[model samples]
Target: MKYLLKGAGLALLLGTTAAYANDGLMAEIAKPEQWAIPTGDYANTRYSTLDQINRDNVKDLRVAWTFSTGVLRGHEGSPLVIGDIMYVHTPFPNNVMALDLNNDGKILWRYEPQQDPNVIAVMCCDTVNRGLSYADGMIILPQADTTVVALDAQTGEVKWSTKIGDPAIGETLTMATMPVKDKVMVGISGGEYGVRGRVTALNLADGSEAWKAYSTGPDDEMLVDPENTMVLGKPIGADSSLNSWEGDQWKIGGGSIWGWFSYDPDLNLMYYGTGNPSTWNPSQRPGDNKWSMTIMARDVDTGMAKWFYQMTPHDEWDYDGVNENILTNQEIDGVERKLLTHFDRNGLAYTMDRETGELLVAEKFDPAVNWTTGVDMDPNSETYGRPAVVAEYSTAQNGEDENTTGICPAALGTKDMQPAAYSPKTNTFYVPTNHVCMDYEPFRVAYTAGQPYVGATLSMYPAPDSHGGMGNFIAWDNVEGKIKWSLPEQFSVWSGALATAGDIVFYGTLEGYLKAIDADSGEELYKFKTPSGIIGNVMTYQHGGKQYIGILSGVGGWAGIGLAAGLTNPNEGLGAVGGYASLSDYTELGGQLTVFELPGEPAAN
Candidate 1:
């Protein structure tokens, strides 16, 4: 049953009781029939309720339709299905096309932006757009050249366009925007270029700046109330973020917010995680590097930091804490608790209380993770939840000219930008993971405006004592703190995971195969080869009483950055930074939307 709200009830449900400009328009996003947000819902679960073509019959699924995205460096986002029209976004020039689903997926209209071609060189990874957010009859797009545009949902007309970041300074916008009430929230990416990261809110009525919060800055700029902001049952002291850094380095300190956002309507709060510090050389800026590698909760309307917990204090290996924080209800100690589960790039999966920043369960999802022994979560312990570094693998501790060998789970961390999906039916997190390690050597580098300021040299390969495969797809049981089932892959599982009510989980591999597996047991049910590797998220929608699954296939993200940068191993240990050496040999890059459905015509509604 789809939840449809109207009038005051709709407004109340959205927590927009204070009356914003577009209260009614915002409530339409929660309807089950539409994929309003990039992560499928405000909680960023990526789980769909549609189940007409599930488990038992999923094996009968076949390709229903296919469309090509002309310009593709990396198609890293899923198509947005609203009513009978599906929205698709491509990379580089960032094209938006609407296809009428009821009429054989015909192109209704397409909008292409006049973006500056020079911006492509500044992008840290491949040129990719994370998709769009729909609200107030507009498809909100965050272009690669640091511009945000709102297009008419029906006619594809440009309603408003505003500049959010300056590409000349190495600040680019790649992540999707999150719109709530009258605000369309967007964040910046440029940690690799010494660009200070922040999340800005733009008015939906007109593309005007509403408020901005820097991830690493003074309390006022960060919108942090030192007396009120809580971190581990303690108030954050004055200049906590500032005092953590040395000198004025905090100005260029990198805490990029390039991941997914999740909101809690009842609490009227929004949640997001920040990326790594300015440069990979942690010795440059010391002291926990407050707010750099942290998960922060803030007021949706004003963007004030309520509580923040640093996941990787003084991060050394580029292990960004920018993974998705999935909101859901979980039973802990026989009590139903509102929980947030995050499978971090640091190789630790955390389950915490969403209402208050409290750690509940912290466990390692990957057995090959050797950077940290464990996360010490006892509040009374001096190292509460901090990663106990293995001295040999600590690049920061080793300093310049020193090389650290056999760093398991590599600099890519256990995961990358690819998201994991949660199933309420089974209470399991289907995680796509990278199982590789790297040898690192940190060297000092001078910062220039539009150039890479990274201070590390890295080469990745398969971890020791492991089957030479690069990745794994596993079902994680957060409550029990164990792996329910595991599936190994030859290449990194770079695509997002999708779980359905029909007990079917879907994900794509770097090998260009779209796969459907049993939700209860990790057994492969169906597989279809696509034109290219799959780097996009998987989503399901229903049209004309028939359920269909859609995903974008065009691999060229960080894992495939080797291909995009025209890099090949000149020597045995050089070339790509991460353990993505197998990407070129295993897969090639192209763009296409592959939609699947069970055989048979649509049933009458």
Candidate 2:
């Protein structure tokens, strides 16, 4: 059961790493001059070592350039910059555009796929593409039409394309692909539509699918070597995932992998989380629903699962585990361990040993997380190895079908696809989060292909004592498992965060403001109003000898949908998941890429 990253795979990875070294890609990424990977680096820290745009001069930052995508939807991802070229992807029809960074952000080339128009209806949240990844001179994009395409990094021509999911049955692709070694890893989206989720690896050269492992089903389908799949130092045993479900529900059990991914080159394992089970009505499908609401560590080449840990067993609320798994090496209780930190949608934060799938620390990142009283990890304790569900919030299980009231953290849980940034310099994680709660009522839902499969009608509002705000930007200390500092916001912080070595952390607000705060003290330093609310990550790169920061501005995600569509149902607060109905008073809809630089710098080329 021992796995080694040897042979061609190792060589492919070494080639990438060496090429990265030769071209100084790693060094460039560290310099705040080039934003290489989507997650910044393989560690997925989203931390830049750039110091030029320090706190002292951040107020001098001004608009350098802007580009219009012309598609007014949620702009949920950041642009990828390689050398002098920057790549951007749009929603729905999924257009890929490359900008010449040296020529004042000129349009170099644009590739737009003729995707099925009907595909938009099946998307659970707002239509979002989480950005692209560049590897070995190719830009990898996961399209919403259930296909992954590799475009020529230089010319924007289609190199190779492979379909990974079936949109007809409610599967789509929104997460960005991760390029590891010679394989590009991608996952599907459709937990709400009852489509079984999966993660597949494609040969980076020709786009042929290498291997796929499902989030549900039998051990063979999941590539789960249960005898070797250690869950906290003990074997999970054969058919561990399959037996956890009732009947044949595992076929459509909904363990989607639609979030961010991280990797450890030395361990040769890719870490990703899976979404919740299908039919949010937990009573329909019983048992632990293993693999759903879980994180899995898998072999990069073969897609064999080494181990997994379920964050929520039989998720009653729609607490999807599809959050980013950030890889880092941190010390815990006096020993340095290869750690994977995840701020789950279930309102709990976990720090685990990525090498062995052992839980090291579990705590709440948000204080209002009341769905579960606590995550019990002590093996010998009576409430061992599961979340201690709070009876008041267990509406679905409490058999209150007529809209049970008062669920803290709402069905949105605590965070969404907007990922957190980890700064190695300050050893602090900057988390963008939601501070809303909900009232839920679950009804029976019959599955139908390409239709709304959700069984819940929930109304969300800002948590009580939340000071009338729906979001909080916080700095979390993972080693100590504590919140270092928090800044409350008028709306949910739907955008991703960027932490830099210069003691500044940047993020966008749902009200369309881009702000840079003191990374160590949580003091707002600089703020700029954009054309629309921001739902994208902040990426920084140096072009023409000037450091530049950029993010996409469009207000159409689940949090911003009410505002973008101009839905003003103040009393009900029903649509757009009922949480942000008041958003229209703050921002409107638009799609633009805004770039900023210091006032003195000659405009980027």
- The prediction achieving the highest lDDT against the true structure is 1
For model 2, which pairs clash? 33-542
lDDT of 1 at 219: 95
Output candidate 2 Cα RMSD: 4.7
lDDT of 1 by residue, 148-193 (tens): 9999999999999999888998999899998887888899998988
Residue pairs in collision within model 1? 376-385
Query: Residue 45 of candidate 2: its Cα lDDT?
Result: 80
lDDT of each: 0.84, 0.82
Model 1, global lDDT = 0.84
State the displacement of the C-alpha of residue 561, model 2, in Å, after optimal TM-score superposition.
2.2
Off by over 4 Å in 2: 1-32, 565-577, 602-605
Shift of residue 534 alpha carbon in model 1, Å: 0.5
Give the range where candidate 2 is weakest over 10 consecutive residues by summed lDDT: 2-11
Displacement of residue 541 (Cα, Å) in model 2 is 0.2
